[model samples]
Target: MTKSKTFWAASALISLALMVFAGYSIYGRVALHFSGDTIEVKPVPLPAAEEQEEEKVDTKSALEKIKAAEKEDKEEEAKAGRGTPAKTEVPRMRAVKTAFEYKDSAAKSVLISGSFTSWKDKKMTKKDGVWKTDIYILPGTYPYHYTVDGKKKLAPGKPKAPTGDSLVTVN
Candidate 1:
């Protein structure tokens, strides 16, 4: 009888856990449905039949004015080089491929932060004790640095920083 009671208690606990999980899933689905963009519509009763007739009369007058303006637009398009290509020229921008590398054997995380990346920390992956990452940026000069293990520093043999940041130029 003691063994049967133990078995029944275990079964009850498992059943309660399953019920709680199912209830949580249902609550999450209901919360998600109401959380995102929702449109609520309350039915507004239409105007009386006599008031609706007045609206129809005003619409008929407005329709005539719209049709007359459309006819004028058709006439202007016929004279405005309708089938010819437009003479406007669009300016083009090019993207440049650049590689930023840092050689640190003991650093836990190496990041490349620059103007192209909005000066944000972009973590680089380590390979054979050297951290490297490639970035595609626009053709321009950008000043940047390598943040190694939470310290802001530059790579070896870099030029002196007037802006306290090393420059990388892309042409």
Candidate 2:
């Protein structure tokens, strides 16, 4: 066999090995369960008295809530001949310490500014030359970028190109 063909075969083998190892790391060897294993589902416990009371007070069904809101809007419109729409609720913060990773680069400093972050400049500083933040947020996705030397850039804490914003996964 020619040297070129041998080199290609070696490269293919190395790629396959890397893929196999990646799969193993993601799913630990003993983590998988077969049909023989028992299901681990559990029943949810009952809500506390206070929780139940709160839920009762807010017992409007989705349709009921929509209808009530529509009614309120119509009444307001008739009274005012139309008015500005109610302001949108921004997504609240959840965890502050989010990780940024892109192709082969990582974030030096990442700050998020979306409706979630109230569009405020919450600067995420870098510790050990790695972006570290402790911001609280709610359940929602938003556009974010890293700030390097007061310049806007995408998070690069994981693996990605330095020129574009990418998804940053948190643990």
Best by TM-score: 1
- Residue-level lDDT of model 2, residues 49-156, one tens digit each, is 997877776775665897788788878877887676666576755565544422223544455553345446676555555555566554434445555556666654
lDDT of 2: 0.54
Per-prediction backbone clash count: 0, 24
Question: What TM-score does model 1 achieve against the real structure?
Answer: 0.48
Spell out the clash pairs found in candidate 1.
none
Off by over 4 Å in 2: 1-111, 157-171
- lDDT, candidate 1, at 85: 35
Please give the lDDT score for candidate 1. 0.76
Question: What TM-score, to 2 decimals, does candidate 2 have?
Answer: 0.30
